[model samples]
Target: MASSAASVLNRLLQNASRPKKPSQPPPSPSLILHHINSNNFAAAFSALFSIPTPLSIPLYSRLLRISASTRSLVDARHLESHIISTHHPRHPPTFLLNRTIETYAACGSLRDARELFDEMPRRNGGTWNAIISAYASAGHSHDAILLFSRMNKSGSSRPNDVSFACALGSCADLLALLLARQIHCLVLKYGFAKNVILSTSVVDVYGKCGIMSDARKVFDEMRERNAVSWNVIVRRYLEMNEGEEAVILFFTMIVDGVRPLNFTVSNALVACSDVSALKEGCQIHGIAVKLGFDGDHVVENSLMEMYAKNGLLEDARKLFDDSTSRDVVSWTSIISGYALCGRFAEAEKLFDSMPERNVVSWNAMLAGYVRCLCWGKALDFIFLMAKESEEMDNVSLKLILNVCAGVSDLELGKQVHGFVFRHGFCSNIFIGNALVDMYGKCGNLRSAELWFLSMASNRDKISWNALISGYTRHGRSEEALNAFGEMQWETTPNEFTCSTALAACANIFVLRHGKQIHAHMIRNDFNMDVIIQGALVDMYCKCRSIEYAINVFEQATSKDIILWNSMIMGCAYNGRGEFGLELFEMMLKDGTKADNVTFIAILLACITEGYVDLGHRYFNLMSDEFGIIPRVEHYECMIELLGKHGFMVELEDFIERMPFEPTTPMWMRIFDCCREHSYARLGERAERWINESNPLNPVEFNVCSGPAMEPS
Candidate 1:
């Protein structure tokens, strides 16, 4: 039977040997339905192609769904061809064409989707949303935003809530506050103000764009709220590092009787992690357990992160080990947790044992190594990651740039710079800033300036800080001050830049400029965090302005140990040893703990006061009382104190009882001290040791009262 049918069909296909006056039969819709019912969309499409008949709108919509599900560009194109045959070439049904555009986008051929959309003679809100969502989801935020603008101006389509939501999302992604506000106005003008989803999107955009007050206003105005709205507002606070606000909102959500979902619990945990709120995290964990989200993978991972970030590594490890549904995120979180606490060996072990890894996982490990300053291993891991074709994003590049700066690997930094340009990440200002920082720290000031200038209008406070810090770090204090001057003209000085400026002033002893910066900070209401306060004290002290330094220290509302140390050391160095001692007593009374640097200052004070007995007691107190087990610097200060007081036997005994062999600098310091005291015998012995330690650069002191110079 098959052979007979084939032979007859073959005779009919041989160019019709006999002409017949027969009519072409109508196409069978049942055949198309049969193929469709059997779930063979490709075959159904083929049958439709053969018949070339119009399909019902419902059937065409069904076909579009199938094409989109398959995500096959071929299926999309075939369906489009059938649509064109069924309708006018320039005008398919608007709804059908909208779905077609979406199908093309889902197939990842946005160009084809766009061409179809452009060729459409008419469009509706769905048409605009289809393309806008496609671009937004694919991370082309700029293009998506542009399309939304065109849609608004064309007036061909009255965009609905979805269109505004997608546009607002793109605005959030781009941080385009102005466009976000415009879209927000459109949402109101178009009467979508009551839409909860649209409202949440507005809040998200405002929060992400750093207009928190506006975000809060929109959020408060929402007459009705959903879990999504709460989550969006809370997560916005987390993004801004306002962990307290996020946690407060989470509690408010619970009090409002809105039970948190798994992601909600996860976000709350992240907030706790941000603030190191272990008790609150534990409370959330209890809530999760009661809500049955404790077993959820997302909540579990966040729990581990919370514990780890709060330095409860053992608790985190237990959760990691007990997790039953650990995904890649779970693994990455646990790995990052270990790495956060300087346990790289354990982190790498877990990372190696992971079942699957993504770029986040790789970057987390790299960040761990970078944090621990294991520069060589970080470079190796990133290189190996690249060799394995793992996609390196901007974070990885920044880490590599940091490593290059740390190791002064200028050649490698340049290569990474080239990679940045090639990979089209040059527009990322953070990466550009990293490049400048890398070049600056690597001693390539010229490259640093060039990169900074190339940034043009993109230069932010960090760029200026990096340039000025480089000059300050490498002892070009004058240039650093000059750069700071230039920065003041280009942009308002931030706290970091002001701090660097103060340091430059101190280095050059330009008390006038330091006073000006201090006044400017006061006038501008700059963020006078503890760090800036410390810098102010250090600058004033280093410039020999003990009175002014005291004024800054006394005026500071908040003071850390660093500030205390700076004040003490400044007083001691400026010949106010007794007052420096009083400050130390005050530091202790104020509940501030002293470190090794503090004791060094104390020893210096004792030396200035000629209290040899007190210096010995304090040196002993470093180990016996404070448990600071003195470092070589502390020991040197003690020996200098003893030698300056002509306590020869005690200084020699202190050097002999040292835990490690004396270094050239230690011996040189000893020789200078011995010469100061006219202790000739010990001076010659110290000279002998300096010569033995650094033979190439022989010591040339003549036992006279001349200033010491660098060995040559």
Candidate 2:
């Protein structure tokens, strides 16, 4: 046994002394990564620590990457400390430090990431990128920009593609056009333009800065383009209200053979929606199907919205029903579409059917009710929304306030105002504008002024316009004019602002102010749209400038029926019945179809001029030739014509044949005419009808009885 032990010890020493063939070096760091990737984290970590210091660097990097990806801050910190302890006094390799910084940033420990970045004895492009990206992702855009400037000044590290992309993103967030341009110059100087991501980032910066011309220029200059590059420009155009141009660019993108991403498809559909370009929308929808993106929820929702906004509710409904994955936006889009198309009942039904509802979904339904003039339903929805936990947003308040103003419901407007205060939405500029308009419309000028004063610092053109329009609506024409002058001193008035000012001038018959506004329109080269033309024509006529009204009418580039009606009514009011008839004939000659208003104006002219035959002819022709059903005013014109001409029998026959009961005002008109002609018998008949219409009010009967007067 002694001899065997001696021989074994001799053999062990002999084996140790033998120059052993170098055993295959311990499993590489890649092997350790293989274990980590397979989720054998225990074994991977054990192997990581067991490896030599030089090998451990790569192993630690792989582990840090996994930690960052999984957002395991604990493991990340542990690994970071291990790297620090293992490589202390001498700085860790730049790549390991970068990965560690990235891990910390990804874990939302930006403080740690930034501290480690600061402590790093050396940094490359990757180190700078990680920290800049960290700051940008955290919404510290200014800090990110400052760091990027430091990187540019630091001669040790040059701005690479990643660095440029991060810096450009910061500029985008900051909307720093000058800084972005400088960075763009640096990108070009550094030959980073060929990097697709860097180029895309530059384009995005320009877009966010509202420099679409530059954005397009950069995009056009790109040697290579991707889906993101196309999307950025298309979305920018949409934001700029160049929807038609956006659609054109979308088609151009398609022809360029770049495949549309999901975002691209959604943005293009928005462009189509804005322009109401149904044909182009349909073509894009077809492309989406071919690209298999039609099934994508965002694209489907956008398509639904486009169809809805274009009045293609049928197609919108079809798309809604066909969508397999319907989210809140999908339901909201369809509901809003129905509401916008004036199909309130369908919108309500669909809204009730939604399984899950958000604030946006509720707002859409409420807005629909308001738009369809279902005032009671809209108010009820507001109350219903109050009962729920879902908080009302600014859009909800704006829409409901509009409904209150439209229905002249002061009580409800006050309630909405209270809600705005309670919800702290009073500070929202849009809500402030809405409140001003609502209170003005409700005849609560005090409240309107209060809200307007409160929002003085935040007042935009819309805010000023709303106030001016409100004053005009309530017959505070002088106040509206003063407000207009104040607005001009503060901000440049838009077309709406000028148009409302013109309306104020018309209401007060201020010829001087009207002339000034007209001159301003001319100097500013404002487009003579139908609204402005109508306003000018009405203003001239109201100011006793019928020739000027006629001049304005003739200068209109494209006259809709409203403009034509305005001119006709102007002539009628000025007692130019002959000229009114001439204008009507001109309207017909120009293929401008007459509506109920047209016939009403023409009938008024006939009545004023005592053209009884012409009155009868136009009244009959209204329904027979023009398909315009005679409204109350048309009937009033007819009755006035017959009563003034002493055609009592025909007037009585017309009254009996009327479709609806004569309102109190209509009966008052008949009684006045009877008194004018001293027809006691006919007067008594009209008096009895008025009394019957208001049995409880003897005042109306008494007033009519004592109202006999001399004929004109």
Specify the highest-lDDT model's number. 1
Residue-wise lDDT of candidate 1 within 327-407, one digit each (tens)?
999899989988877898899899889998888998888888888898888889878888975588999899889989989
For model 2 the TM-score comes to: 0.83
Clashes (N, CA, C under 3 Å) per candidate: 0, 0
lDDT of each: 0.87, 0.86
Report the Cα lDDT for residue 573, model 1. 90
Best by TM-score: 1
User: What does candidate 2's lDDT look like per residue over 1-712, in tens digits?
Assistant: 9999999999999999989687677756777778877998767766655555555655677788788888888888777776776675576778888888889988989988988998988878889998998888888899999999998898888988877888899999889999999999999899887888888898899988888889988889899998888888888889889899889988899999999789988998999998889999999999999999978988999999999999999999999998889889999999999987778889888988999999899888887787778888777877788888467788888998898898899998998899889979989998899999999888899889888988978898898998898899889999999999998888888889888999999999999999999999899999889999999999999998999899989988899999999998998899898899998999999998899999989988887788988899999999998888888889989998988886666776788999997778878888877766665665777788877777787422223344344343
TM-score between candidate 1 and the true structure: 0.83
Model 2 segments more than 4 A misplaced: 1-38, 42-55, 150-158, 178-182, 185-196, 388-391, 424-427, 588-593, 616-712
After superposing candidate 1 on the true structure, give the runs of residues whose Cα lies further than 4 Å from its correct spot: 1-31, 49-54, 72-92, 111-147, 375-391, 411-415, 418-425, 489-492, 523-527, 555-559, 589-593, 627-712
Clashing pairs in 2: none
Q: Give the distance in Å from residue 334's predicted Cα in candidate 1 to where it truly belongs.
A: 1.5
